[model samples]
Target: MTTPFGLSSTATTNTLVLGQKDLEIIQPPDDAISCLKFSPLSIPQTYLIASSWANDIRCWEIQSNGQSVAKAIQKHDAPILSCCWSEDGSKVFTAGCDKTAKMWDLQANTFVQIAAHDQPIRTIHYIQRPSYSCVMTGSWDRTVKFWDTRQATPLKQLALSERIYAADVFGPMAVITTADRNIQVYSLDQGPTEYKKIESLLKYQHRCVSIFTDKSKNPNGFAVGSIEGRVAIMYVETANPSVDNFTFKCHRSTPQPPTNTQDIFAVNDIAFHPIHGTLATVGSDGRYSFWDKDDRTKLKTSDVIND
Candidate 1:
């Protein structure tokens, strides 16, 4: 299907292709993409939403044949930095350089300002628990705010030492990375208070982070990526010395036979498979790789694509 932005390829099979032999290129935003999120598992249809530097958010419904249909588009005053799908996949939450966060209801086709910060909202997430539900927004103003959509003001706000670079929340655990390479863990069950704080293992600037469950289906560990082409696997429970916490180098190119030098690229993003728990990392090298964190091995690596 051809869109106003670009032409999209239609796949023959129902499976979605990414960095594989048969790739499907959908309509892209006018500027660089800052964030991309897929619909929650509860939703039957696969919907992808992307926030871009062009100050707009675009949603696409993935068809059975890997075709992407433009579902919705919402504009913002400034570049959108991040976006996420609600637990039920019925709504989307976005935050950006405009210092505000907005919620988009897919069913009603409406947008509402849900939260605000003093500085650019860099990251956002929707948190839903049996006892409570709210939107989490992390901003460059060095604060993390939780907002109840029904009310105008934030339900809770947590101040940090430095500006937030990235954050991720899973189950009741929240991991936040700041500008100074400081990592803080929060327990939602304990009311937004700081649970434990740890210094990052990587020496370079942190880029992205993701939470993954352990064998018991509890979120006890998380992956942190840095600009130095490294990922650190950390566990929340450090009391157990038996737990394996390690860091590995990736997204780097080996030098030729005559030279021992290597080219290192920043690890742009890291995500763990919801079902299998395997991790995937995308980098500035234009390559993505899947890894088995427990086994400490790369499962698959995709060919470099020319962007």
Candidate 2:
């Protein structure tokens, strides 16, 4: 996988390889990579997190040249499905099949189990604020909850009919997607207790897999990826009516894969380049493709991760 926000092109057929100029192999593991992230402010240093079906989350430090340069950074008791770093890069947030989300303080080297959802936590994002920051989590319970990092109790919660597939916060808004094939925008204006639904639509009839805000590009524009392997770009304008203000445009998917690559892949997650609007996509088939948000064109591709 392309380092979370870093850049790499791999050409591995069965092995994860760094592809632009030539082929380079990434270390092979017994388990598949469940999630990946790049270190904040760390250039060319990326973390590859793998979760085993047996309930294990393993972290590997990868160099720009496609080598697993260090030992696993950490481990968890249950199968980890999602992982994210604090906005300041000081801590890490993780969710697993254990039905709980944990906060890890790198400075303290301690892990604290925070809250237990009704089901496994699927996605999470840490919001950075000048005064205080918070972490938001999405679970299979069909609800999304916000938790204050300094406190263990949930600050607020919102319910939905279908299980939540993805959730992330941007500025004062949190965007959530559910199995109902709809994306709901919730406002944190009055804290979670009085959440006002800002937007609701079935942008994708298929399960929405990833949602990300392009704060670096346009403050109000964000993107979402789906199980059908399609992506929709949206712009959130709060000036409009309550839930009818935002407008979204579905970008056409790249042309079908070459006949030989029919089984090519699907997107796992999308993260905007910290400095630019370029998008990094990790495919289930293991190909890490990069696209320019402005033009929505493929910029680069990497080898498939070993599953």
Candidate 3:
């Protein structure tokens, strides 16, 4: 199929007739999954790594024969709260409630761990470039730290006023959300002194954050999730930055609200497809939705995940 943007791709999507979801199975640790991410397309085989509250991280490799093998890697002293892969997929970064971060070298079978913070680390992000290769971590200690692969400890840290909940870096921009309903967008230009933080007009506590979709290696903006079932799309660079940003309510009760009240649920996750501008979201209410932010259209909405 070809989109109006001249992008083409192949897919095998079936028409979902009922509210039930497409065939799937539940598989993972005995504890809750804190983070899950698929490997980059540059890798030969597709694999998924999931971090858990059990202090163990697991990986699943899909074989050519359609079978899959899973492996558990344990090292964290406390619950593993978040995980992310290096841009090249050579290493995986994980942070946990143990107040530490660790790097797992997949091929070398070696791991390096370090004390990351005084409080539990909530998020981890990897941005690897020829000139700059570093891992960024956000924690409940109310700070964001940057770790260089060449150093044994973090080289720089950015302090904020609230507990960090989620973070993501795309190209030269980074967006981070916190429990205080603040969304901080940073400029990843040069050194620590050159970094800039943008002001946010959000009013609800944020849950997740993700950069916008782009195949040309540049992102226009990012989306922020809140506990009130709202997603805010914010642009970093624009003629009128405030006017370019917007928010919408979603994944809540379909029927009318009660007299003088409204139903509220947390937006669990938000991800943008690389080839298309389609934004997919999951909510604590067990409902999922697909939206085209470019066109302001709701593509799909289904109550497939029962609470």
Mind sharing the TM-score for model 2?
Answer: 0.70
- What is residue 190's positional error in candidate 1, in angstroms? 4.2
Clashes in candidate 3: how many? 0
Error of 3 at 103 (Å): 1.1
Worst 10 residues of 3 by lDDT: 3-12
- Estimated TM-score per prediction? 0.91, 0.70, 0.85
Order of candidates by TM-score, top first? 1, 3, 2
Supply every candidate's count of residue pairs whose N, Cα or C atoms clash at under 3 angstroms.
Answer: 0, 10, 0
* RMSD of candidate 2 to true structure, Å: 7.1
* TM-score of decoy 3: 0.85
lDDT of 1 by residue, 1-307 (tens): 6432243434333334564546353667999999999888898889889999999998887776666677668889999999999998989999999999999887777888999999999999988887889999999999999999999999999999999999999989999999999999999875677889976789999999999997788998899999999999998887753458889999999776776789999999999987899999999999999999989999988878555
> Which prediction has more favorable TM-score, 1 or 3?
1
Sort by lDDT, best first.
Answer: 1, 3, 2
Off by over 4 Å in 3: 1-27, 63-67, 192-195, 213-215, 256-262
- Model 3 C-alpha lDDT per residue in residues 121-150, reported as the tens digit of each score: 999888655467688899999999988866
